[model samples]
Target: MVEVEAAGLIAIGAGIAVGLTGLGAGIGEQSIGAAAIGAMAEDPKFFGKGLLMTVIPESIVIFGLVVALILLFVF
Candidate 1:
């Protein structure tokens, strides 16, 4: 019973962490993506930098996913 409760707590916490971080990352990436596309439309040469900047938010979600997975399995 205690183990189950602890696991539940860990799951909840991990979920919350992932949810918040992912939400922020999604929002951030969307903004960057929009800007990147707009910039690219103006000048094709800006593609590299714009794309790089847009994908920068991926790290946040990746890190959050790592933490969430670790919590789910390790706990």
Candidate 2:
């Protein structure tokens, strides 16, 4: 019984880890994407840099997923 409860808690923790990070990344990406678009508008040459900047926030979500997996599988 105790082990079952522990497992449940771990699942919850993992879900929170992934969920919050994804939300945060989404919010971050929104702003970055807008700025990237604006920058691109001013100078067409900014496209590469703008795209790179816009994609950077997505890595946060990947990190979150890794954490969640670790939580679920480890300890």
Candidate 3:
């Protein structure tokens, strides 16, 4: 019974960690996306930089997923 409860708690924690990180990534990407669009509108040359900036925020979600996977499988 205690083991089950502990497992449930761990699952909950993993969910929260992934959820929060996803939320953060979304928020970060939103701003970057907006800026990228605006910059692209002004000058096409900015596309590369804007794309790079936009993708950087995506790493946050990847890291979050890794953390969740580790939590679920390791602990």
Candidate 4:
């Protein structure tokens, strides 16, 4: 019973880690994407920089996944 409880808690922690990160990244990406589109509209040359900037926030999601994996398997 104790082990089951521990496992459940661990799963919850992992889920929170991933869920929050994804939500944050999505929120961040929305603003960035809008700005990128705006900049690209003004000058086509800004597309590359805008795309790079927009993608940076997505790395947060990967970090979150890594944390969740570590929690689930290592903790």
Which one wins on TM-score?
4
RMSD of 2: 1.2
Candidates' TM-scores? 0.85, 0.88, 0.89, 0.91
lDDT at residue 53 of model 4 (Cα atoms): 94
Put down candidate 2 lDDT per residue, 7-67, tens digits, no spaces: 9999999899889999999999999999999999999999999999998988988998999
Which pairs of residues clash in candidate 4, taking residues 3 or more apart in a chain or in different chains?
A: none
Error of 2 at 6 (Å): 0.8
Give me the displacement of residue 26 in model 3, in angstroms. 1.0
For each candidate in the order shown, give its overall lDDT on alpha carbons.
0.90, 0.92, 0.92, 0.94
| Candidate 3 lDDT for residue 44 | 94
Evaluate model 3: give its lDDT.
Answer: 0.92
Predicted model with the maximum lDDT: 4
User: Which parts of model 2 have CA positions greater than 4 angstroms off?
Assistant: none
At residue 21, give the lDDT of candidate 2. Answer: 90
Give the winner by lDDT: 1 or 2: 2
